[model samples]
Target chain A: MPASASSIPDTVLVSADALHALAVRVLLRLGLSQAHAEAMARTIVAGQRDDCQSHGVYRLLTCAQTVRSGKVELQAEPVVAPTRGAVVRVDARRGFSPLAFERGLPALVEAARTQGLAALAIHQCFHFSALWPEIEALTAHGLAALALTPSHAWVAPAGGHRPVFGTNPIAFGWPRPGPYPFVFDFATSAIARGDLELHRRAGTPLPAGCGVDAQGRPSTDPLAVAQGAMLAFGGHKGSALAAMVELMAGALIGDWTSQESLEFDAGAQAAPCHGELVLAFDPARLAGGDPAAGQQSAERLFQAITDQGARLPSQRRYAARERSLQRGIAVPRALYEEIEALGG
Target chain B: MPASASSIPDTVLVSADALHALAVRVLLRLGLSQAHAEAMARTIVAGQRDDCQSHGVYRLLTCAQTVRSGKVELQAEPVVAPTRGAVVRVDARRGFSPLAFERGLPALVEAARTQGLAALAIHQCFHFSALWPEIEALTAHGLAALALTPSHAWVAPAGGHRPVFGTNPIAFGWPRPGPYPFVFDFATSAIARGDLELHRRAGTPLPAGCGVDAQGRPSTDPLAVAQGAMLAFGGHKGSALAAMVELMAGALIGDWTSQESLEFDAGAQAAPCHGELVLAFDPARLAGGDPAAGQQSAERLFQAITDQGARLPSQRRYAARERSLQRGIAVPRALYEEIEALGG
Candidate 1:
């Protein structure tokens, strides 16, 4: 849907269902419960539909390897603890993050309804997918939500050379009375590591301020940046945001910081266990005693932006989803074969 | 404290108390009540102590003029309405934002303690100061806080020509068990409008991607950018954040959007009325029933960053505050005289 690998002669077209079934079969072979496999497969397919190939089947092989390595507990069930009236904590027991989220989100939404606002902290899980889906799910329940998580270290501080922070991503969702929710997710780094890797694969130069060379000099060479470190986007502002995410997702959740993640990754090839923070706000309770008024306000704001010819965040993803639903997903033939072999 | 205009030879040193008294006197002359004047003056003095010169006395003259022009109600009191168990809405009665915050923050804090999380929305107010102080107040009461506010539109959306978004600022505060809370505040724009005005005054070139020229072309000329529009930081990512802030502070609060503010400002030189959204989280309640564990985790995260020789956000402001507290604030001679004259 988003300019597939047309240059590759071995590109293949597959239906979304087929892709999902293949992913489930491969994950099932690698020792995952039917439910867990189905959950992970749905996320991967959604990523493909939304044009985020890096988060799609591109990571399936690695996911299978990680599970095979036994670093991720195949049979793990999250322990959800409601620590307070509006605070929910989920210990993922070193399992998949999606399952933890699935286990805790309903309770989190319920808490928000009762207390006006609620927070969900998920720790000891491998989160290797796009965050939008999780926040999107909250919006589906007519709530405003924010989600943040830290990954393995790749980004450097604004002025410093070494990588000290993760390419931390933050996502927000606002539910209007309209048909769809307004949502967006982005990494705090100048460029996502996946994009940098794509540039390297294409033999393209990176943009200015994207990353630095080994000598701590700003470089446009993707290889040099890959070898050195990525810079935080927008200089100090992005660095500050990355730091905030570290506090919220890592420290507040009592989970691994970027440094800790790196240390853990040093001894294993599996994805490092991470943490997530999700916040839900009940508009009916917070919007001056009338939720309809709040929804109308959101509608007016969205109209104002669209009137200015300004594209809203996640518009492209939604467009891609529409196209993918009609045309099916495009997968590279080589990758398809690899997945097929894994299924067998 | 922050390398004041000592090179200008006309810089004057003023004690913090004297500065506060002078600001209060000037505002009192402009028809603000004693309580309102004191509240406004405290914010001004705090801005100076923290080295936020643009938010300090530099903007006091404009504020007085706006209030005199009847754009800001001088004697109005904020009306606090508890919409739900943990949500409060403060209609500022078209008065000052600081007063609205002062009126609602106590209830908001109490709600957070009772329910683990709470939100406060303030609308119909003139907000012309740094947001850190309000969030800092929450931290002082041992709460983690987040605040956002929208201003008059000046920034262009990503990949768009015309200005459609405000330089919406977001602030976050984490109250550690340490002596000081970790806090950071930043505008979503590539640079704060105040700093851009400073660059224009100095005839300096803007940084890459800071803004665009009159033709919607990216320009480093501060004057051209002044004539045109500022760009969002980190391109699309920052634009999305600015949009999120517009929704949270503008739509969610049922207040004027940035475009509405601009329309209102079109007929006058007064500062546009804006809105603010503040959220408080009680760490003791939300941090898995063990507040000390949360504190230790935060300390570890901070140490990890410091170990890389990377400076923390607001480290400079904290340092400036220490120096200003010890040696008093520095003011330009002409500005000092202007304030002294206004007080009379």
Candidate 2:
């Protein structure tokens, strides 16, 4: 193990490097190839570095279980098709999505850089991360990016009584000449599935607008809504957007919809095997003028937002990232121990 | 001036062709060239044909006033830039967007067909129509499309009190092997600006989530919110989307942001002169497989939605379109007379 900070009974502070190396070791022991282990570890460490604990090291439990059950293609290599204009296709070969995205980002970035716009379609993969990481990666290349994917059938369309859509998420990133780019990743559903699970684990009532009971009636019980259907945010409009995600990421790519993905999950222990769509736009190409002027123009809008007392969407996450960089991430002692013991 | 169904005290029926011609005549009388008048008329006819009263002939009232103020470049022609890779641009020359969109569609369709994906950015335009017409037009060509544009500054961001964003609208279309495509066009705001005006005229209270007063307190008064701030739909998520529109359509295209557009409006009578962004994706190029097979796969998801007894968005509009085809459109006599008297 690498260096770590002093620990307490309930919380353990670990350096980002140590946390990443530990995650890689655990994944390697659990059956992932070294290449995939490194890729997955980078993603998990990013979640913790940003203080998004739900997607942090806590995910190793599912990874271990899913692999043990022979659900994941532990050694499968992702394949990228030769670029066809502005659309790039990546076949994940029934493995996880992170490695595939990593392999294909170069092609996507190249296409967008030259063509002004490009879309990447990743198929036959179990997507395990929020889209922000992919969006951020594109933003790092000074590209504006939009990403979407459908998960297991856990959310109901607005006005429907059963789950037909996933906790489909849409994420966007706009490049800026600042410390961090403007980014937002959110599920079209009223609440994210991970958040719902945390609420249920704590035996807490859900906030209003979160969900409907099994009978399609409003309910505060996290367990009930978890077993029932998650409502789309903003009612019908959000539902329409969720459906758009299903079509764009799923049908448009000739992959499984959320319903089909859930059916494939069978026992439901594994993450949903699905598809993702990512579109990146280069401001310089689109502006048809000076890219610097475009960036300056965009800054005015951001300044206007902050000046009026409204916080930008990812300010909290960015602040947490700053803090985590200074002091290591603190994790629950019990959860940390569990992750440490995953290889046992 | 033209043949009409015998007028009743409250309503008069007009054939779609007749209605289109009337709209053309009215716009022509207001100084629009014949080509521009015809372009604008088709959009107005489509709205009434779909039973969307808010966007129908009533829009002529605003069009007349706007043109009379010399705010519209009535004879200005749209110029479509030769395709630059997968991006196409149309300079509206300060005219209404309808004629510009008409002139640009062919180039956009060709680019999307050859490149798998394409984006059409229309700049320096006064957009005065709902986006569905543009979306549906693309769907008619067997393509999936999405369009968005910003309007006058009238909406508040989710956490902010003052209005900074527009009633930005997003529209999407998916092609299917059926009479009507899967389509949805909606404002990011809780309620559309036209609907608010209707509520105020009828002296009805605004919907619960519609708006806030000048002090940022929630209010049901249409007039107060109109003078104050209209809320974004779905809270923070919708607000973020609205902001995205501002960047993609405004700054990304090097056009006016909503705030700048409002400042240009000065006394607030002209339609927002900004930019529009439309993205078209070719199912065939992106699928890299059998196009018909992909369409078949998409139909399964649509079937699942209807199987759950949940109505898909735009079903009512399609139904109304069918009715209008058979029985013609019924326009309230008073409003019809108002439109007629404008030409006189």
Candidate 3:
């Protein structure tokens, strides 16, 4: 792989196909269906290709453990039902989120095209994968999309000392008349939980306003924050956004809130079972019935932003994907060995 | 009047009705139709009732100045046209936004109720009022709503030196089966331009991360920030949100981006003529024709938030509204006098 600035000498470089095969093998061994396993593997490969290591093969071990522990059903078949008007619902049957999304997204997109807008409410799934893939899929089909989900609580509300919110994430994608769509996905917290975990492992200090210690005092020490609560990214504004996600993904979907998810986990090693809300909009219909006008508007917006020298969101991920395709994906030797052990 | 903690002897108290009458009179004197003037007055009154003084009567002086300067059209009628399927468009006819909204919102709500979701794109209007009032109106009709709008440039990109974004506010409202809907409206900037102006007038230092100095260094001096650029609320994440708003409200609505708005204004004292995009979702359709279930989910979400002692968004505004009803809206004597001068 083209070496990352932080890559060590002991890192293992594997072709993208090899990494996908490895993930599929391990998931199949855990009793996943052939189609389900392959879908899961593709998402893992996308994560690795995009340089989101936390959501890549590093999550395979937990997936195996969760399936073995019966927290995530191995052969569950998600059921998709058309709700009133253009809304659809997916009962994940406690399976992985990828399978549920696979079954629901096509219908959602069709509904949006027919009705101008549509919504998908997915529940009873473990959504540990990156959100960008799903939104990107919608944009690739010439549709605009927004997705929100609440995870287990790791963030504290503004002025609060305890964890009451998740690293609740919101993702949006807009289809333009170009090869790449405008996509952005981010957690509402100051940093992702995995990033904080890395800082703790390396014994590094975090930036100011990242988190608070057990006594609610601002702290740069990652270990202290791990033992306490992480702060929302932008004080009250971030807190408001986190709460909004909770309401949209949790309550609106009739699924567990972040606090409820924590209780459901009950100290388990598996990822939390969460809900996801995805919205798709057909800009062709919204742009006075002219699809070209909608695409032109999006192109104009991209030009305006780029002219200001502002980096488009997810631009780095696309760059990383190109490098990984040219060379390979770099993984720590230890992690690769660990995955190999799980496969057998 | 129930006194606010920050209220001083220089504050003048007026009944909400009287304030509304005064605003209507001032707009009518500036050549607005009676209906348009009354609609505009109601929005201004709502801002003061909700304790948002920055968007209340304090803006009347500038409103008059802009109208008298022939920037904001005084007697324009908005046109609402159904584009395709559930989407609708409003040509604001270069008039006030309140009139456009007044004419278009009912049709937008009806379209959403029929199609499960609808979008309203408003253009060629100057939008200067608080967004909460509009979104709250949607929730009042049992519809979930989201609104985004761009303004004059005052915020810089994450690492860029000069401003390329406006405050770029976002507002959301979730309908619940309760006395009030869950609502939130906030600027993507660390602090709003009006709030920064207040700090500058008071000769006070701003909080950390609020803005950058002319040299692109973080500064606590409000004066320096006023002369420089405001920072996005949470670095890159906030910057992405501001850009998203600009795309949706500016390019999508065929209006001006923040930079373009500045160029159009040409250093005028009047408010920038911006665009707005409002989305309405009918939960009755999304909840599988069972609106009660949607309401119940919202109620459960609110309960969970309140159980954690996390303040619900807009709770403060509701409390302020109650207090204003019991007593009166507190306005600075100078602002009241300035508005009175506009009436003559």
> Each candidate's TM vs. the true structure?
0.93, 0.97, 0.92
Q: Lowest summed lDDT over 10 consecutive residues: which window, candidate 2 chain A?
A: A1-10
The candidate with the higher TM-score, 1 or 3, is 1
Answer with 1 or 2, whichever has the higher DockQ: 2
Per-residue error (Å), model 1, residue B64:
1.0
Q: Output the lDDT of residue A18, model 3.
A: 88
Candidate 3 chain A worst ten-residue window by lDDT = A1-10
Top lDDT model: 2
lDDT by residue (tens digit), candidate 2, A248-286: 888877788898898998975688898899999988888
Question: Per-residue lDDT of B1-344 in model 1, one digit per residue for the tens?
Answer: 22345645777777898899999999898898887888889889988878788888876887976876677889998899855767878998888778889989889899888877888989888886788999899999998889998888888888775677889999999987655689999999999887887889899888888898878888989999877889988788899899888878876666767777777777576776878899988877766646677678678777766776878888888898887777778777888888888899
Segments of candidate 3 deviating more than 4 angstroms:
A1-8, A200-206, A213-215, A220-224, A289-310, B1-8, B200-203, B213-215, B220-227, B288-310
lDDT of 3 at B218: 89
lDDT of 2 at B293: 65
Q: What is the TM-score of chain A alone in each candidate?
A: 0.92, 0.96, 0.93
lDDT of 3 at A114: 81
